[model samples]
Target: MMKCKINLNPKMLNLLFLISYVLFVFSLFNRDVSDIDVFYSFTIFAKYISLVLLLIGILAGTYTRKEILWFIVLLCIDFILFIKSGVLVFIIISLFAFHSTKIEDDKIIKLAYFTLLIFTVITFLLLSLGIFNDALTNRWVGDSERHTLGFYHSNVLPLIYSYLVGYGLSSGIYKKNHYMFLIIINFAIYYLCGSRNVLVATLLLIGSKWLIDSFLQKSEFKKMINNILCVFAKIIIPFLSMISLIVPLLMNHIGFFQKLDFILSYRFTAIYKIIQTEGIHIIAQMTNEMYFDNKIVIDNGYAFLAIRYGIVMLIFLSAIIYCIANKYSDNTFVLILIIIVACINFIDNDIIDYSCLPYLIIGEKYVLESFKRRGNNYE
Candidate 1:
């Protein structure tokens, strides 16, 4: 990654905004996540942009030995996920292109900014239009059983988008903008989307970023954060596990007696059933119906890999998280993004784990390094 002073053109800047818009729109009407409308059209165009990225990397990576290795390992994971998850690869690719604009020109940064903004605007509009006129989420996206504007309530969109706005305003092209305004806008979107997980994720992201920034400004912050994480990693979850298991589920059903035997609840039952389905394909069918129903969808990233892919892939994922867990720094916005996304994976099941976006993050910074490397050669 080369760094120098550069800017993106307005049109290109807007592309990032539109990409976010497309992602939100894609989530709205289609329960299956395979349907597309005008939103993802640019996603089709951005595939070329990814090729351009590789071309640039090949030309300049003569000295970016580390990056080249990371890129190869990344591409291999990308290929496997594509085969396993279907169209999600495109979303990752598009995000890569969008986030790749940093260390470029002002125009390029603006392009990424506008792309996110377009998403923000379109998502709000989708909900508002539905509310005001009593229309569906997207006109093109017709009826569905889930929580679309006129559909289903997956409860994760608001969290993801809200974190996105936080990522941008916190360290984005819009860093100068009011963080409160950015958060409020996304929170409104969360309400309209009706996703509690997103709300929790957004709060955690903001709190984590603020706390880390404040404490880490002092020399002791890193030690403090590590200590806290270590404690939570060990002591807290274990003590809470029994409480979590003992939790009385709230059910809106007939007869208090039937509901009170909460020990016979779906979750406890699901645990036993998960054990039972070890040798058969029926679990897949059961999981399909449970896709976005708060509890199942918002399990750990590890569980998501198992449920969606397989136990083998889940092991690969554990190894990847282990590698990333210690390697990355928490001082940057990317670090915050990683923390939030990783936490979301613990519960939200729909995401692509071990994604390709890290390459995009690298490229954004690397472009500057590329320029620096160029400058050094000249010197």
Candidate 2:
């Protein structure tokens, strides 16, 4: 097997990752500038430049054969789908995954947390100045104005803020201090964004943690739960990918499902429309046209993947997530964090977001190493 032996500076690589991450986050916020063309041009330029820096850092680092193979497969799929951004981001993530075994996980995580903290502060300042009012006003939030902290839309802001809350809680737990301030800030952002899905995800994460610790205190119960989850984890990717196909069919037959769809702001309707128009296939053809009537966005991440890349690609992507989740199953912090992210992906486009990809890859790498260590011990 060809082994990666590149010895890149850890600090430099961390710095590059931080910069790339920040730029990627910034690119998501669709600022309402007077010059529309200039705004798009600048955003695109910043995005690609950031990707280039991350790619350079990745190339300078070590990689394994498995990482290279996965990268090639994903790159081919992205090319077929004509998703240039996804291709670049996945390559960077693959490199990170391959090199994660050689680097300090805590250091990379701390840098990411620090970057998020700085970005949140700046966003708070901008929100205070009323600079994001125009964008806020443009969002469809049922008569009431919703603040987004200068993001492109209100729905996505809470999901982004959840990361801050997660990092803050993680830091507080590590330092042995309850971070009430972080929770307060997260609640404030949640209120501003008015996204019920984000609120549910945040509450579920916290509630689930407390429940696991308090209710599942017995070792036997814990072991049983872990065993069950391990079995589910192995098949979760393909199962969920197949389920996505069945959802639209159920919506058509069930009245309660339609009402449930309405509660989720017609997400089901949009998904159903896409399936009806596009027709479910092994590999979907790339199209620039909107799938739904009157330009309704695909809010559900699974549905989006199914529409754009088809079930095969969705299975591949979900398998990647499953690997990450499965590897980190032993660590409560990592396991819960992955669950929280996966839950949020149900209602948002976070599955392919830049903020979560690095961590997923890193976690997968950690697990892979653990397996190798076990094999060596056995031998």
Candidate 3:
């Protein structure tokens, strides 16, 4: 009797990974289905399936020693993370990022576009049908009501819309003429959600793309402008990370910093409170107050990562961002998108929580190049 061997086709693996990815993304954003047993099981199933497929791909494929070392390092970091927080999501996402190295950028873009669209439509439908309630509340006394539109908070709806516009416009999926429609959507989101910061970020996405396109005729000026933006891109993550950490320490002492914190809705104060409560660590540890009862969510992404996920995780994220910035230094649109996201990260915790396209691109550009350099053909 001859032994049998099963060889998984790489293309099929890629297709399966993409499907599982979208399913996982859908599971993440569909708030109503979270309590439903079927969808809850589906989320777990999708995540583990994606993880298994990625593990198989990594083990079966040929890779350089350096690449293997990098994988090991990531595994160790994630293992520490898992031990500390009892969360496997970070490791699963790391595997997804690695698995994405072999896939095409276009595939990720199209799938992300549709996935986000479906999520948005479903959320709206749920809200309209009264299945999901709007988080209508006033943060300050005598303030107007802000609508969440079925999301966890008022800003979430507009933030998701901003990401949709960012992915669509930066990928060239949406044309310049679509800016009017997109801007109208932003205004409507602001009207309903009352998220001014996200509204500005959304408008900046549209305006930056338009400005870049108009100046394309002047190659020298365009190149100069892109160079400036690229430099900003390289430093934005570290700069924001520093500010997120340092601002809280300074806010009480400096009136300017205090006013800035007030403008940011006292995010610095929240950061200070969390720091005083749980404290920062090299590796993120389980907090006594895992679910804060203070009613104010940590809005700063950098602080959230550093405080919640650990300073090491934040550093790892910054390194990944630097890699992306270096890889796309010449791609002005993507760089601008990075800067926009980084700016928003200062106030919003959406960078790693929700967005998938950036990581996919990072894997495509940085991870794929590593394999290619070692004469490994993913195809």
Which is the leading candidate under TM-score? 3
Clash tally for model 1: 51
TM accuracy, model 2: 0.77
User: Candidate 1 residues 1-379, lDDT tens each?
Assistant: 4422344454454454344434433333233222234335654555445445434333332234444444455556556555544434433443443344333433433443454445445554755765312233521256332344422333434544654555454444443235466568567766565555567667666666566555565655576566445433323322322322233222223355235334332433343244344322212232332444534432344434444545554444333333333334344434555455555544444344212233233333443344446556776
Best by lDDT: 3
Q: lDDT value for candidate 3? A: 0.73
Would you estimate the TM-scores of all the predictions? 0.52, 0.77, 0.88
Compared with the true structure, what per-residue lDDT tens digits does model 3 show for residues 1-379?
1111535677776776666677667656654331234356666776667667667765555546656566666778778888777777677677766666666666676678778888788777877887767768676889889987777678777878888888798678889789899999899889887888889999999998887778763677767777888889878878999999998988888899899898988899989988887788888775435644444368888888787778887676666677777777778888898889889889888765546444534543464355446545544
RMSD values, in order shown = 9.9, 4.6, 4.2
Where model 1 places Cα greater than 4 Å from the true spot, the runs are: 1-114, 125-157, 169-179, 182-193, 212-216, 219-222, 226-300, 319-340, 353-379
Q: Is candidate 1 or candidate 2 better by lDDT?
A: 2
Q: What is the lDDT of residue 178 in candidate 1?
A: 53
Worst 10-residue stretch by lDDT in candidate 3? 30-39
